[model samples]
Target: MKRTLVIGDIHGGFKALQQVFERANVTENDQLIFLGDYVDGWSESSQIIQFLIELSEKQECIFIKGNHDAFAEDWFSSRETPGVWLYNGGKKTVESYADYSPENLKLHLEFFQRMKNYYVDEENRLFIHAGYSSMHGPEREVYSSNYRWDRTLWETAVAMDKKLSRNSNLYPKRLLLYKEIFIGHTPTLHLGVKIPIMKANIWNLDTGAAFTGALSIMDVNTKEFWQSDPLPSLYPAERGRNK
Candidate 1:
């Protein structure tokens, strides 16, 4: 089995993302899957997009779209309401493209729209931005809405389904089912974990890295995890400078 590593929301924290990858020690054979929210919240959106594009060209990397990414796509593409993206932490994304004109903005928006909603491997390990519930259907039948919202439903389903599977091993073949699902979006602290960490058989890796928490990554097979130190407090003077 190939060792896969799924990362949480990056939110323009490129340096932190790099540190997590380094700690994971990704190999050429190991595929890295990102849970999205790649831009916004921080000031390095441009650099982070460039890096992700480069990595995608060389390695087996899959990108999933998060709600923040949806905002970015709309903002750059000029297809959304004017104030929505700007209100949703998109100020940094707009600033990231300061050097670009209208044409470049159009191109960037196209790139964001190209991102996938979710990824399901041969092992049925579902990688999505948020999560789906039983209403979305069984693990194999998840809907795109699950990827953008509906975590509470998914959590309830997982608890019930995993419990039943633990006892009966029925409903579907085990190999075709996911041993786990990886997601990001909602901050894990809100999920009751004292600290930012993976939880609920669904790895809640977001860690609020773009806000008060640190960025994080976890190994899919071994459960090993890595994170950057909490982001340093920035003075007003240093807020928008690219690292």
Candidate 2:
């Protein structure tokens, strides 16, 4: 059977991305779902985009848009540098494109434009870069930015009383909308964990590849996961976003 692999935030750690793929033994037959933050952190941001563009031609791939991606897309279109973005790794992303021609840059911008804010599969499994606030679902979300910027969903999951049954009156209604919700953006490292974390029905795949942690990938069905070395070790000379 084909495996559906859910990947975490990449943050321009192309080497780490490559390592995880190989370690996972990924095949073209498998479906790849990337949770985004594809750029902005390490020095290989441009290269990662180019590689993904080429990889998509060989197999099925789903791309979800993250906040960093949105910021990069805005800059690509307007060339307006946001100070907040720069401090949070956008400077490296900008520098990564120094050698790119106008044509290639346009293609990368188009790729970013095509990314989805959230995706719900046939099994009622939601894949999103961050969190959604709508109890009705992402489709009914009033503020679209919440799809990529909200952390309340994960926070709720993390804070829930483990003894509280799902059928309880006090159980969060938002958790009932999907069988499983896979997300990135919030690093698992924040909780002092270095691996994909499952709280309630939500799965947080971001292993902090933008900082001192590893890049991670998981099989949605089996829950089996693979990871690359800690990003800092992979880029010894670079501080990544840890600074």
Candidate 3:
């Protein structure tokens, strides 16, 4: 059956991406929503972009920009490597594209440039690389780094989930903006789980592909998921400049 599939941060684990895609049986019929951070972690950051580009050519892919992706966009436009980006696994991403032709580089840049900050589907489900705090409207005021860097919103969701009085009056008003919200920036592995964490209608899909966990894909409608082999096992030899 066709469904809207949302994937968490890939960070550059091409093998993990492939495994999850295959496990989920992704096809052109599925609307694939990638919750960004496609680069900077595993060794094949450039290759992952190439794969996403190729996938976009055939499937209905909605790519949400991640904070790391924003940094990569900086390098794409200026070719300037900021110390922070380089320190946060950006060095591996740069090296991954070391020999690419200028034309291909431009194509890569174009891919990154076109990524959206957030996407609201027909179901009113919000897919964002990070959580949003905007109470203004459905269009959301999180057009800034909040779309890719905000952790406070997710933390609030966690807090709401922990509280027992989640009644109409007690539930967070912020989360009421969407039917459900899916995010990736803060990894669930940090919460002691290497799989998607669902709390108060907010699903955190990032399983720390940038570190020791696996990449994850979930059918947003059904809440069923598929995960790759533990990511570290995919590239046994290299740590991939993880941060």
Per lDDT, the best of the predicted structures is 2
In the range 34-117, model 3's lDDT, one tens digit per residue, is 999999978899999998899898979999999999999999999999998888889889999999999999999999999998
Model 3, global lDDT: 0.87
Sort order, lDDT high to low: 2, 3, 1
Model 1 bad stretches (over 4 Å)? 79-81, 101-107, 134-143, 154-165, 168-177, 192-200, 233-243
List model 1 lDDT by residue over 1-243, tens digit each. 567888888887777787877877877777888899998777778788878877877888888888888877766656454565665667877777788767766666766877998787887677888766543334454465666765663355344554454435454332224667777887775655524354335567777776766778777778778887654443133342123
TM-score of 1: 0.79
Q: In model 1, how large is the Cα lDDT of residue 66?
A: 88
Sorted on TM-score, highest at the top, how do the candidates line up?
A: 2, 3, 1
lDDT of 2 by residue, 145-200 (tens): 99999999999999999999989999999999999999999999999999999999
Report residue 218 deviation for candidate 1 (angstroms): 1.2
lDDT of each: 0.69, 0.95, 0.87
Quote each prediction's TM-score.
0.79, 0.99, 0.95
Better of 1 and 2 by TM-score: 2
